[model samples]
Target: MFGFSIQKLLFTVAVIAAVWYGFKWVGRMKKVREREARERLRRQAGNGGGGGTGESGESGAGGSVSGVAEEMVECPACGAFVAATGAKSCGKEECPFLG
Candidate 1:
């Protein structure tokens, strides 16, 4: 009787392992589908001319240098933002944003 019970226990263990592996496979498939859907959406929006990154305008009295990032520095004196390369803290010594 004990030997018969042991055989049945072994069969149950095998069945449980198979079910766990099957569920794991299904989860992986679902994740792949979600990733593809997001990529497609990104591509469609990009082709529709929704935005421009890495873009700059010609430099004049008030223009960003061509092909250069417009860097702005925050003033610690008055909280005003200014261009990093040519910015002074408003020359206001009393300003909290002074830096």
Candidate 2:
């Protein structure tokens, strides 16, 4: 009877340990996913801001302007040339840019 009780206790301990380890593993995975998500967001933010400089003196410092004539696109509403990636209406209330 004592040996049977010992076996039951061991089985209970094993099951508890397995559950604890599973929880720990899940928590660790969640932390890793959160860290990876944060890294992706940081990379996206950096890319969105357009970092670095060109071979010439231009550092691409202008807001929303790529400074490259080839990359510029004309806005149909206001006929204003803006960065192709950022081309939009002139943002004038009287212009179609507002919509």
Candidate 3:
């Protein structure tokens, strides 16, 4: 009878552990879903409610018909491509795009 009681106690403990871990897993999944939703909302907000086109004067995968694409200049300091719209530098204080 004592051995049987020990078995029942262990089973109850195992079930409690399972429930705790299950709740933790569910909480992690909920956090991941919330983060993804927030990321999507931030991206949509940054798009400025445009028709997903070049209406905002930004170049995209599809060619823009409203305006000519601004030429991308190679930053001599960092060798990074940046727009040539009065950009004296690539916004990097350490390495300004002099060239």
Candidate 4:
């Protein structure tokens, strides 16, 4: 014969709560990942569709197209990577990118 006790009831409630919270956490994480993936795809699409040219048949340098991944170079002075296109001085005397 099974007899229900207060301890058993409390334990069951705790287990249910744990499972509910776990499910909610998983769902929230899944939604966050999905949203991030969508954002990445949107950025990629907006970035000239991976082509260096835009609808006007001009290169990305013309400013007509954007989202192109630029080459990054390490700053000799700061050792931090920066966009190579318009690299600027890091205010260090030895910075090679200094203009």
- Among all candidates shown, the one with the greatest TM-score: 2
Q: Give the winner by lDDT.
A: 4
lDDT (Cα) of model 2: 0.69
Which residue pairs clash within candidate 2? none
lDDT of each: 0.70, 0.69, 0.74, 0.79
lDDT of 3: 0.74
TM-score of the candidate numbered 4? 0.45
lDDT tens per residue, model 3, 1-99: 999999999999999999999999999999999999997885776675456564443345586443444677877767887788766665666666553
Kindly list the per-residue Cα lDDT of model 1 for residues 29-98, writing each as its tens digit: 9999999998778566445443566322222557544433458877776788887775666777865443
Stretches off by above 4 angstroms in model 4 are 1-4, 49-99
Q: Model 4, 1-99: lDDT tens per residue?
A: 145687788899999999999999999999999999997886776665456654432244655443456888999789989999998889888899866
**Candidate 2 lDDT by residue in tens digits, 28-64:** 9999999999977855655644646523333547646
Worst 10 residues of 4 by lDDT: 53-62
Which one wins by lDDT: 1 or 3?
3
Residue-pair clash count for candidate 3: 0
**Which regions of candidate 2 deviate over 4 angstroms?**
53-99
TM-score to true structure, per model: 0.46, 0.50, 0.48, 0.45
Looking at candidate 1, what is the lDDT of residue 90? 78
lDDT of 4: 0.79
What C-alpha lDDT, on a 0 to 100 scale, does residue 75 get in candidate 4? 91
Off by over 4 Å in 3: 49-99
Which 10 consecutive residues of model 1 have the lowest summed lDDT? 50-59
As a whole number from 0 to 100, the lDDT of residue 73 in candidate 3 is 82
